[model samples]
Target: MQIKLIAIGKTDNSNLITLIEDYTKRLSFYIKFDFEIIPDIKNVKHLSEAQQKDKEGELILAKTQTSDILILLDENGKQMDSVAFSSYLQKHMNSGIKTLIFVIGGPYGFSNALYNRANGKLGLSKMTFSHQMVRLFFIEQLYRGFTILRNEPYHHR
Candidate 1:
């Protein structure tokens, strides 16, 4: 299965972008992984938190396809260890899904439609993080998970 990361905004920091690229490249060795950045909504400063989420949610939904499995990288969702995370990927790959899209929602979080559209949710940690930073963290973890799955030296218990 191809794994894609769909995030709401761009990563302005050069350092973060470099790290994200590094992990993203490493991930390509194990699976077809791509990070797609959805452009930030216009005039978001004038909108309320709910409105911003709704607008971002529309962009998120637009990027998804009917056959894709949508998984939200949310804070309140289930948190699993590295080993279990690898097994989770194994299970999905075995299920024969065409594409698996993991979303990093906007700062205000997801809308009702996004929540309903998602098939599952997985949390990285309880601590709050910027959307840009979460992109790097999640991608790195994904690379690590695949390395662990292959019994490679990239990941150590």
Candidate 2:
């Protein structure tokens, strides 16, 4: 299955972008991975938090197909180690899924509609992180998960 990461905004930090690109290149060896950045909503300052989430949710859902497995990177979601995450990835691949889509929502988080539509959720850590930083962290973890699955030296238990 193809793995896709859909995030709300672009990364302004060159360092983060460089690192993300490195992982993306490495991931291509093991799987078809795509990273999509949905542009942030305009005039968001005037909208309430819920309104922003609704708009962002629309953009997020638009990128997905009915057959895609939608997973959200949410703070309250299930947290698993690298090996377990690899197993989760394996399960989805084994299920004959067309695409495994993971999303990083906007600053305020996902909307009720988005949450309802998700197949599952994952939490990277108990600590809060900037959305940009989360992009790097999640991509690195995804690459690490693949390496572990292949018994590569990149990830050490």
Candidate 3:
């Protein structure tokens, strides 16, 4: 299965972008991985939080196909350890799905419609993280999960 990570806005920090790219390259050895960035909504100062989320949600949904299993990287999502997350990846791969999309929403979070459309939600940590940092962390985790699946030494038990 192909894995896709969709997030809003560009990551301006060169250091973060370099690290994210490194993990992305490593992940490609195991499976097809795509990192998509939705441009940040314009005139956010003029819009309410709900309206911004609604607009961002529309852009997020538009990138997906109906068959794709959408997972939101929400703060309140189900948290799992590294090993469990590896198994989770294995399960999804075994299910024969074409694409699994994980979204990191905008500053205001997701809209009601996006929440309703999601197949699942995953929390990387109980503590909050910047959207840019989440990209690096999540990609590295994906690489680690694949390594664990192969019984590699990348993940120390």
Candidate 4:
């Protein structure tokens, strides 16, 4: 199955981009992986919180096909260990999912519409993280998940 990570805005920090690229490259060997960045809304301060998320949600929803399973990266979402995450991925692959679309929402969070569309939500940690930093974390976890699946040395039990 193809795995797509759809996030808003580019990572301005060159160092973070390099790390994200490194993990993304590693993940490609295990599964079809696409990391897409939706441009940040211009002059966002003028828009209300819900307004920004509503507009961003439209763009996020547009990226997915009907067959895609949308997963949100949310603080209040389910949390899993590395091994469990690998199994979760394996189960989805076994089910023949066309595409697994995981989303990292905007700074203000997701709109009600986006929340309604999501099939599931995953929490990396209870601690809050910067949206840019979450991109790196998610990519790295994805790489680690694949490594665990392959019994690679990258993730130690």
Best by lDDT: 3
lDDT of 4 at 99: 95
lDDT of 1: 0.92
RMSD of each: 0.8, 0.6, 0.5, 0.7
What would the per-residue lDDT of candidate 4 be over residues 1-157, giving only the tens digit for each residue? 8999999999899999999999888888998999999999999889999999999999999999888999999999999998999999999999988999999999988999999999999999999999999999998999999999889999978
The CA lDDT of each predicted structure is 0.92, 0.96, 0.96, 0.94
Give the clashing pairs for model 3. none
| lDDT tens digits by residue: candidate 2, 15-110 | 999999999999899999999999999999899999999999999999999999999999999999999999999999999999999999999999
Q: Tens digit of lDDT per residue, candidate 1, span 27-69?
A: 8989998789999998988999999999999999998999999
| Stronger candidate by lDDT (2 vs 3) | 3
Backbone clashes counted, model 2: 0
Candidate 4 backbone collisions, by pair: none
Cα RMSD of predicted structure 2: 0.6
Off by over 4 Å in 2: none
Q: Provide backbone clash counts, one per model.
A: 0, 0, 0, 0
Candidate 2 TM-score versus the reference: 0.99
All candidates in order of lDDT, best leading: 3, 2, 4, 1
Select the stronger candidate by lDDT from 1 and 3. 3
